[model samples]
Target: MALESLDRSPPPFFRVGFAPLTKLFFFSALSVLLMFGDKQLQFTKPIRAGLSTLIMPVQWLVLQPGQVASSVGDYFQNLDQAQKDLQALQLKQLQQSARAQQVEQLLIENQNLRQLLDLKNTVATPSQVAEILFDVPDPYNQRIVIDKGQTKEVVLGSPVIDAGGVIGQVTRVYPLTAEVTLLTDRDQSIPVMNSRTGARNISSGNIMSGTPLIELKFVPASADVKEGDLLTTSGIDGVYPAGLQVARISHIERRVDISFARIHATPLAELKGRHVLVLQPTGIQAASKGKAP
Candidate 1:
């Protein structure tokens, strides 16, 4: 009875202010009233805007890692695409270079053919066109092979000439090709006449020891030969036609000890021609015509 009376009626510190249900109802009504006033008055807009502004930099910082990863991936993809495009462009450039070389070669060939045609109109003798196939394998002799042969009626000893002048003569004939001995061969000689004066001499090839020159062998020191005088075929040798170009006098040397003059001439024909004209032997043609009824 003493313990119950000590506590039950007891401490002022344990005294109550309000009931728990009453406190809960009063706070709930206060919150509803605040929400209704805020909606009607629109007073919280500036506060909401300030709060959003404060959160924006943090939002950006949070997204930075993902954005950097996407940028790195895109950079690598672009670099790979650029490398592929550069390779493609390089391949195209190589193809264009090859085609351009072929076109330039074709233009040069066409120009040579046109010049040959013009030369053909100027030739008076019966002639035929032939393409030079290749140079002969013998290095000692300056010779070349042509595409015309026995089937083309390319006779042995036929005179071969280029646009500028006489180049060679057909020395060997095959069924489909022929070998031409060029004028610069060591064993070749032609009877040439000076066009300025009527003097004549035999011009032999490679006479100055180791040079591509024709030496007028029998010319006297007192002969009327001058440097730069043009030489043409004398027509006495029935192999070549008269007045066809042969060479030009390049140098003249005379010694009191010798009776003959040492004369050197440069052949006017292009020895490295791609195309040539083969003239019918004048003697053979004349003989055939003579035998004709």
Candidate 2:
């Protein structure tokens, strides 16, 4: 009986008061109340800010890989855009350079035309401007076709001159186009007078030489011809006007065995120009041609 009474009742300090669910509800309500109070009263905000500031570096470190990847992606996109812009700018620069060069060329041609115009006014023979239509396709000959022909009173045997001097003579005339045989042609010949001594010399084209050339034929070894002596039209053939420059003696060689000296001359007129003047003598007239079809 004494053992049963001792085990039947426990001490008050050891007694169970409430169920586990009731304790859980009480603590949960307390936690919710604390959170609401902290939010409403602005409590713990400074503490939160301090904690965030302290861990910022650690947070940044943890996210560094993602940031680096994003930065690398942006860098590649920017680089690609820069390369495309650079290529477009380079192409635009090339186009601008081409336009600038064309403008420069046109300016130079205009200056040349001005000089030719002044020369035309000073000369007595009436003339007209003619542009080179095209080069004669025969690779062996140095000849060009002019836009002016019988339609423009460009006659056969008409003298063609440039700013420098005689360039060629009209050999063939069409209704609206003409062929000018350059002085460098093998079959062409001109009568030139020595400006120094008034002596006559026949100028013939040099075909054997690779460069443009004119040779004086049958000039006696003792002839007064010298290097740098200017030659002009003698007007003996009436094809070219008098006193117009034809060639200048560049070199003279006299052989003891030969009777005449070999004379080489350089033409003053440059054949590379696009524009030329056709001179019409006062007495000569081109026959009117039938209208072009």
Cα deviation of 150 in candidate 1 (Å)? 0.8
* Per-residue lDDT of model 1, residues 1-293, tens digit only: 67656655647898887999999999999998988988999788888899999999998999999999999999999999999999999999999999998898778667766777787788777888899899989767888999999999989889999877889789999999999998888889888899999898888888346777788897889899899999999988899998999999999999999999999999999754477888998889899999999
**Candidate 2 pairs with clashing backbones:** none
Estimate the TM-score of every prediction. Answer: 0.70, 0.79
Give candidate 2 regions above 4 Å deviation.
1-24, 36-58, 281-293
User: All candidates' lDDT scores?
Assistant: 0.87, 0.88
Q: Which 10 residues in a row give candidate 2 its minimum summed lDDT?
A: 283-292
Alpha-carbon lDDT of model 2: 0.88
TM-score, model 2 to reference:
0.79
Tens digits of lDDT, candidate 2, 195-286 = 99999988988868787889999989988888999999998776777899999999899999999999999999976568999988533732
